[model samples]
Target: MTISSQSARDLTANITALSDKSVALMHQRSMSDEAVTTFQNILQKVQEIHDPKAALRSLSAEELDVVRQAHSLAESINISVLSDEGAANLLNAPGHTKDLNNDGLTTIGEGNMLTFPPDNAPASFKAAWEEASDGLSTMDIPTHMIFAVGLANIGREPGDLNWVNPYASPDYDYGAAVSEIIESVEYQYNHNMMSFEQYQKNMSFYNTLTEALA
Candidate 1:
């Protein structure tokens, strides 16, 4: 029988956790020879799931049943666990790096997958905005600001700095205003003690609104 997508995903997660633990033990120089051997065995099982062999090895009905049951049990377990170093490592990944450009401008986002302006924009303000707006539609706020703003700023108008200006004219740079909000959101994200996923979700909304209006 084939493994369900959910089952494979669950197993992959457990195996990842196991891999993490094994790596830790290696670093600490604390694993016994037997423990190391057991870890390798588990890794092989994980690889079998990840890289299935083309040849279907024969198994007794009972053996197949046991494998099915194990898969089910793995799925039923809660998987929202964070390892001791999960938070620290997540915040420090290459995606979360905060190095700004020479212009003191840089995009910041969680987990790094998206980059803004998509490496291509027309050489005009309207073309840039249109392209940026299209890209922003697919991006979460954390990613757009963190990955795209530097590119967006290539030759665009400077966003407004005085957000509290009650008399700010209709010509007020709303892009800058949205940027300030994003910056504030980032401030709270890095300073507060909250789940990274939650922070990312909240910032997604904030960014969506900003990008939509921009």
Candidate 2:
């Protein structure tokens, strides 16, 4: 089903207000344990929805809307608060890179690959790329999907490239697909590819939902 533009706008507004309130609470509480636990629970709920690729099929429209808003919020949180060092560590972590080649990279479809920044890349670029890549990997989806979404965030359209999934699939998992899309959004925000207002919108959406859910 398609969401109308007005409905989408209204949903965004509601989610944004919720996020604003949550952030205010966090600021007021200085991220106390209670506040942190609440945030973690909300994130856990989002992760649970995205972890099973098939779970999405059962959701109602309202549930799906919440899922979409939550995904955006999760992306913002991952991009804004997840540190470069944290991201790099996840990429280089033992067992994480087993799928990667000697250079710590893996290919997705559409002639795109996710990799640790080369030594020649600027330090800032390397850090951001690693962070984005790391965040993408944490989604517990196929590596290829993660790569495609990351590329998409950078303005590379997988459909335009006639991208083919390298992994065997009965069907594309919608939950995983959405997870990747959210990761790509995080990548864009982390890299400053999105406008500040856009970034704030995402963060507010995420923070507020997190607060309310907490």
Candidate 3:
């Protein structure tokens, strides 16, 4: 899903307002230190979520789900704390990365199959793969996914010419790729091309991919 610039600004403003209201309520209710800390942490996350310039960081699915639920509970406690629309918008906001719901995996798999077509694969597979890859090309690619694809390329064959290692030590290429990926993700985040949640998801997906591939 895509969020227009204006919509993003509106969402950010709404979240900030809601957080402020929640903070006020916590103070009014004389919440315990632990409870206050929880609210404060949630507020910090919400702020980071709406800030386009924030650094890219991984956010687990559970964390986001919890935040969404907490926002809902806060609204229920004080209707003025958060509007229905604001809560919905925050929950439905587009992710910061392009690897939403395994799209990255699909793209990588399709690309690999197309690049090294299996002898037993049918022609129809190639046609379908091409169609899927073409569609993905039109969307913004997450930096982490790009790095993953590059790593996959390097791992495909010992001496594959497609692998370009810019680092002085070839052994450090993977580390360099990781650094580049982080920088690219941050650039996209700062540019508002992707949401903070999406960025987090991309990082989480990348970590999983790395583990499995390793």
Q: Which stretches of candidate 2 lie over 4 Å from their true place?
A: 1-43, 46-51, 58-60, 71-125, 128-214
lDDT of 3 by residue, 1-214 (tens): 2235455444444433334455455455655456555544544465546433221123344444433343333322222333223332333222211121111121111112111122222354334334434434434334433344346555554224454422223133343454566677778888998899988765654444344334
The alpha-carbon deviation from the true structure for residue 26 of candidate 3, after best TM-score superposition, in angstroms, is: 59
Q: lDDT per prediction?
A: 0.36, 0.35, 0.39
Question: By TM-score, is 1 or 2 better?
Answer: 1
- What's the TM-score of each model vs. the native? 0.21, 0.20, 0.22
Q: Can you tell me which runs of candidate 1 are displaced by over 4 Å?
A: 1-168, 193-198
What does candidate 1's lDDT look like per residue over 7-65, in tens digits? 33333333423345444544355544554444344434444443212101233343323
Screening candidate 3 with a backbone cut-off below 3 angstroms (N, C-alpha, C), the clashing residue pairs are 95-198, 96-195, 96-198, 96-199, 97-198, 97-199
Candidate 3 lands at a TM-score of 0.22
Q: Which candidate is the best by TM-score?
A: 3
Q: What is the lDDT of candidate 2?
A: 0.35
What are the clash counts of all predictions, listed in order?
3, 3, 6
Model 1 local distance difference test score: 0.36
Of candidates 3 and 2, the better by TM-score: 3
